[model samples]
Target: MGVKEGSVLPDKNQQESYIDKQFLAAPVKSAVDKFQLIPEFLKVRGLVKQHLDSFNYFVRTEIKKIVRANDLIISRVDQSIYLRYKDVWIGEPSVIMDGVTEKLSPHKCRLSDITYAAPIYVNIEYITGSHVQKTLVAKNNVIIGRMPIMLRSCCCALYGKDEAELARLGECPLDPGGYFVIKGTEKVILIQEQLSKNRIIIDTDKKGCIQASVMSSTEATKSKTVIRMEKEKIYLYLNQFTPKVPIMAVMKAMGMESDQEVVQMVGRDPRYGALLLPSIEECASQNVYTQHQALEFLEKKVKKSPYFSSPLEKEGRALGILRDVFIANIPVRQNNFRAKCIYVAVMLRRMMEAILNKDAMDDKVEDYCNIPKNLYGPQ
Candidate 1:
């Protein structure tokens, strides 16, 4: 209680404080400023969370997929060249130079002005014509080439070291490691912000020209298949179709034999039917009807330097070429022809919707190419 006028009672700050030291837990403090300390802790946390997964994915999955994709083609090439070889498999990754396996360190890399990379080993077996026997190469690991390694990644030598150990190994105590040590240099792979891959990106320019492209990426291939609307006509660059195949021809090629069917597949809407009329008419003018005939027309459009040996060989090549040209991941086990046709139909439907809808044309849609799970356009 205040006893004097203009005089304050004992303030909370002026009050005496006491603690029994024996009962108190050990005090914790650091030399670093609290503000600075927080940011440093956050920096490490951020690095760990924002870690790039590209390297790990590339090694574990992408490398194997690449090998598998090429295995058959390599085998066939060897057979034609009179050399016999089996499938290919990548071996344990290592860093080797001139028949010597070496430890890859960032400091050494920087000093030597060399990239901190590891050899991509490939295990392969071949046969001798005289013996007719499979012979394993002396070295199971054949050096394919060198690939850059990320620092502190599973592959890095310093990965799993304690702080004290890190210092002994010439690492900074405060350095939150997410960078790659290239030839003794601290290098980092910058975090890049990009549109989702393997999806269609749709956007329209100020000129009112609608443009769309699907970045098709499969285990074996990556391609930016583009389609654009110019002069009120849709021009598609789907796998081996010509630069400007009219929309109707593609529809017809995909087993849309009649205008009514094409119109129905697009939608029951009268507007959709009207939008398809020009394409259907143009398709009729080109006379692309049956799949066989449509394929033939596509084959004619493909320009090449070396012609095939025989009609059978040409046709066989055409089959593979056509599939890869317009779409991907079509296995012999499935009804690829039908599936691809349907896929194209759906693609056309979406493209047409984007072309017609004023809002969608102006608004950018990432991953826009794929049909939604609903199998129907927005109401």
Candidate 2:
């Protein structure tokens, strides 16, 4: 039979559209054999593939029920597939393929998609410096995230200069010793097992401010916990482990009298002498004697002199005089001891000068000894 004119050959436009759709849907695979066209075609095709896959997955998994109601039309354009479910049209178009699936709308369809992951947590412990406490608290605003936080309170009263802020917080006007807690939304995760492995001992007096860290508890078993009280803050630390002999007994053992005169001479302020006097008397009751030895004990008192400024220099001069006048010659009488006291007197005089002329005195000792008043005296 002769072929009829205008016989319906497959619609060339439709065929071309199908092929184009296929290329757009899976550009990488579709262009694999077409080396020359692959580079340009696959570039865009690959970009749209992820979104297209996601859309396809969503359609199959989430929108399948809606599709059965005739509310959706799944169409193949060239090589690409598209869905139009009622007013919403989602697909990878042939001309634009950048891994982005479009939801066609009358005005504009934007894929405002978001994905979420799990959250993380961390813990930290640190000592607190009062000066830095407020600043550390202020840092909470900047470091965002749900994390439990804690910090030790500052141990000193003079932490920050702002007394008003400290007072507002009702923190001890003197010093507040405690820990600050910052609870987050989630429960705090503590590594208790790790913490348990290590041991820390804090020794404090009755007041509870930590004084020391001891290796073992027995070292300080008998001593009462010493707690230092400053203002209202109480600091607890381990007491001296074993009360050896009292300070006076120790002085007596070193061949010195722990008497009031000796104690006062040694820098123990007479104001506290009453409390320490009995300790000295007890040492005298032990018969550790010799006037020179007594003088030697008194020398210890002078050694601790309270020439507040330049104390070391004053101490050195006093010792030099003691050694030259009394200690150098044994069996020295009380009068000779008094004569040697002149060196201590001179040292005291110089110490007073150093305190007064601290602003002007140069490194030279002579400069410290020379008095401008004496030079200009009775002129």
Best by lDDT: 1
Can you give the TM-score per candidate against the true fold?
0.71, 0.16
What lDDT tens digits, residue by residue, belong to model 1 across residues 1-379? 5588887767665563455565455544555544566787776665543453555555666667767765542233245323222323333334657978777566567677777776666655544333355453333556667777766656665667888978776766565555665655677655433444555556664776676666565766766666666776666665554456665555455555677876776678787777667666666678877666666666675545355555655674445554664556433333246666555556656767787775665233344334322101110
State each model's CA lDDT, in order: 0.58, 0.31
Q: After superposition, how far is residue 99 of candidate 2 from its true place, in Å?
A: 63
Residues 1-379 of candidate 2 have per-residue lDDT tens digits of: 8768988767888778667575567745545466777577666654334333433343334333333333323232211222333322222211112965332211111122211111121122222334334221111112113211111111112234366855564444443222212221112222211111011222233653322221221211112222222332222222221222233433332234335444444344443444345545554664445444443444344434353346445434423433332222222243244433332223223332333345422232234222121110010
lDDT of 1: 0.58
Clashing pairs in 1: 106-184, 109-183, 109-184, 110-183, 110-184, 239-325, 239-326
Count steric clashes of candidate 2: 32
Per-model RMSD to reference: 11.3, 37.5
Q: Tell how far residue 265 is off in model 2, in angstroms.
A: 3.5
